[model samples]
Target chain A: MSVPTSTPELLRASVEQFYARHMQLLDDGDAEAWAETFTEDGLFALPGRPEPTRGRAALAEGARRAHTERLASHETHRHWHGMLDIRPQDDGSVHVRCYALVVATPRGGEPRLHRSCVCRDVLVPAGSQWQVRSRRVTRDGF
Target chain B: MSVPTSTPELLRASVEQFYARHMQLLDDGDAEAWAETFTEDGLFALPGRPEPTRGRAALAEGARRAHTERLASHETHRHWHGMLDIRPQDDGSVHVRCYALVVATPRGGEPRLHRSCVCRDVLVPAGSQWQVRSRRVTRDGF
Candidate 1:
């Protein structure tokens, strides 16, 4: 296993790139593709909600379902992320806290802020890339 | 006014220390004290919410009311943060992102996972310290 050191600069860049890719994949409507951003034992859940879907396969399925059930079109939503806290873990993984503003732009309706989620992500090194091991999404209000 | 162009390490450390202190103040039941983390012109708001209070005075008032009206105590709220995205802005300030989780413990009840809010903070240099000029809170859930 590659020992992860505190390269704050690199980690900073990694997060920016990760958010960028997330938006791109989401816009592409490729749930499966987006799911690949996680590790095999990855989890995705609404933070503080009690449970999360475990493993990459389940996460992929969850993403697919969420996309189909909630979003009408990829163009309907856009997001901006701001970091609040970050720390590297002992196992060469990184823990992140971020706030996101998701805006929904329906066909003719004025852009509405859908939700703000405090996301907690655990990222691990996968091959030459950093893949998310888990994500807990928390939403405060509509 | 002090020049904000410090070393990268200093900038990063300042950010980390600022958050550590911020969390400490909140945990200490000093909401007004927490609000003091910002500068005179600081603007505070919770993202996705329409109403935002500007300036340190307003921010302090808002914090006081929220702490009182919510009738809640963060006495047991624990904050964990990670995933930092930091960029030095053109205006001699910094824009950053991080993910956070806040767990609250209530009296005679299971430890409740409180709202996880993203702290979007913009900092400007004040002497050797960085003070927040603006802050936006993006909460994940109740």
Candidate 2:
């Protein structure tokens, strides 16, 4: 596969592709694979939560629980991310901020916007790809 | 401003910036400004529509009519584009295909997924920026 030559180009392209897969894994309820996109000691935090979910194991468990809830509700969720602002840090890590909207469609109903949130992540190069070192999500209006 | 040196990188960056402004103008209900992002003889087509809207004047009028309807409904629409696939053509134009979702929030109600669609565009260089030469949208499940 061809790769972007410059640092900014490379980082932007990597981040876009990373989210395409990451969001898909989440929507597909592949909790373990989704968590694997993060570092072994990745941190997932929310704005109002005092404690964050640390480590890939914890992240996977969290996602699994959410997936179970979604399954029980008979709703399929799709995460759409856009308006990405990617900045490459001096330490080779990239800081990305974007708007994410979760659309949930019930088994036989119209789709609704479940959540509108701002997602920020610190991504570090993991071999040829990138792994999320830390992620913080802030929901809109709260 | 620092620009990417390579052609691919430059095209990618230009496309991203172009959509950033283009979508914002549409959402803000700036019909004329939004239409100006297209070329003078731009074409807008839809899947089932027999005739496409041609020329900047017609595009602006169509956008204005939509804006009027949106105002009457007391709903605000936000266009979120993601998963962009950008390709540079041999003739200096760029082809961009992306998934675009419209989220509409009523005056006093929760937000809903207004529409899910695939947007494809042909963009050409307009001095230092890019303008849409032609656009086609295909609605999901239709």
Candidate 3:
């Protein structure tokens, strides 16, 4: 297998683009690809929730669960992302953060902001692809 | 005058350090330094607030106003920033985004998380230091 590339600018751009695509895949209802974005032992945590979703299998299950229930049926969902920041770490890992908002539109109704959070992520090089090592979603609280 | 350095890593590091120092100055009550971090035409804006604080002088005045009333005299304020991401634009300006939390602790009371926001900044190269060209604060919404 070829060694993973670690250029800072490339890594930052790639990770960000990967995230952009990840959200798109979710909206497209591609559960497998969405889960593949994470490492085998990746972890995901949500604010105000005690238990975390861990590992690629669990991550995929979570994605499929949401995708099937939300986008595949009557309700339409769109993920909006902005304020993306990525840092290439000295050890070759990349730290990433961004703002995300989920808009849900009823079958024949207006759209509303269903949920929003700041995502803190750690990405590691996986061959030519970057995979999430861990992700934490900090929910917006007033 | 030196051409504004455009290397991605260097510019990002400089901007993050500048932001860190900017926060330190506010906590330290060094109003002059805090204000000088902005360009002559710097602007600061907040959500739900229509008007923006424009120009270095106005920026300084706003900083001093907050510092004197909250930090410099009575309560102690602490600003913490993380998830900093800087993008070096082709025009020699850099775009920055990060998460910030402000904690205020009374003389002998508990530290409270007073306010939190995601800061979006546009920084321009100014000699050896990066100056804030524009900053917008979006308060966290539940």
Candidate 4:
């Protein structure tokens, strides 16, 4: 795909679309596809974790584990992201900060809030699309 | 405020910012302020409601009622919007469709998902910012 010249609105829309697709993949339990949204050596840092999960393989493994847990618990999860602050960097990367809410519903049960988090991500242009270079998620009230 | 020439990226960012402020005002129980985010004669349609809510005064009243109910229930509500599909019209209005999730947390209790809804709005320029000309919300399962 050819890279299009991005205006600020276009870039914002693209980033939002990227997150929509990425989160949906994760929610659908497609760990491999979700992991592919990141760069080959992407870094993911979670709250209270000493070492960040690095690389696509590790990322996929981590997502797989979470998917398994949700399955065993008989729940479906949805990741909702909002209130994005996007900044274009001089190094051809975009920095985004947003609120992410995880909603989980058990079979035949009402939906509940699993987590509220603030997510920070660095996205780099990969071919025509963008890929996550690094992401750090800090849970609310943590 | 001077209206800046909007690129697609700028428009997207502006819309996101609009919702951030709009939803915050509503969640914070600022009914008048939240109602002002809409046009003076804005229309709001909700699921199972035969007639849409019309005008800012009525809108404020509705919001005030919701706030009162929440206060009585000792719960706080946050509206999270995601997966926005925005279209800029030739007439200077924008059409935005998004998923909106309402998460409610009672004092000293865990957060729960109050509602999952799809929201559609037509936003028109009001001064340098945008205001909702009309909005329709449909609950996910209703």
Task: Compare the candidates by DockQ and give the number of the best one.
Answer: 4
* Candidate that beats the other on DockQ, 1 or 2, i.e. the better one: 2
Candidate 4 ranges with C-alpha deviation above 4 Å = A1-13, A21-78, A81-109, A113-142
> In candidate 2 chain A, what residue range of length 10 has the lowest lDDT sum?
A1-10
What TM-score against the true fold does each predicted structure earn? Answer: 0.58, 0.63, 0.60, 0.63
Q: What is the per-residue lDDT of model 3 for residues B12-106, given as tens digits with 9 covering 90 to 100?
A: 54454466567767766788788888898889997886799999788778788887798444676656677887677878887879898765656
- As for lDDT, the candidate ahead, 1 or 4, is 4
Location of the lowest summed lDDT over 10 successive residues in candidate 3 chain A: A1-10
Model 1 per-residue lDDT tens digits across residues A101-138: 56677776777545555678888877656788888886
| lDDT for residue A32 in candidate 1, whole number 0-100 | 81
- Collision pairs in model 4: A8-B9, A9-B8, A9-B9, A9-B10, A10-B8, A10-B9
The C-alpha RMSD of each candidate to the native structure, in angstroms, is: 9.4, 5.9, 9.1, 5.8
Interface DockQ of each model: 0.09, 0.21, 0.10, 0.22
Candidate 3 local lDDT, residue A80: 64
- Candidates by TM-score, descending order: 4, 2, 3, 1
Kindly report the interface RMSD of candidate 2, rounded to 1 decimal: 3.2
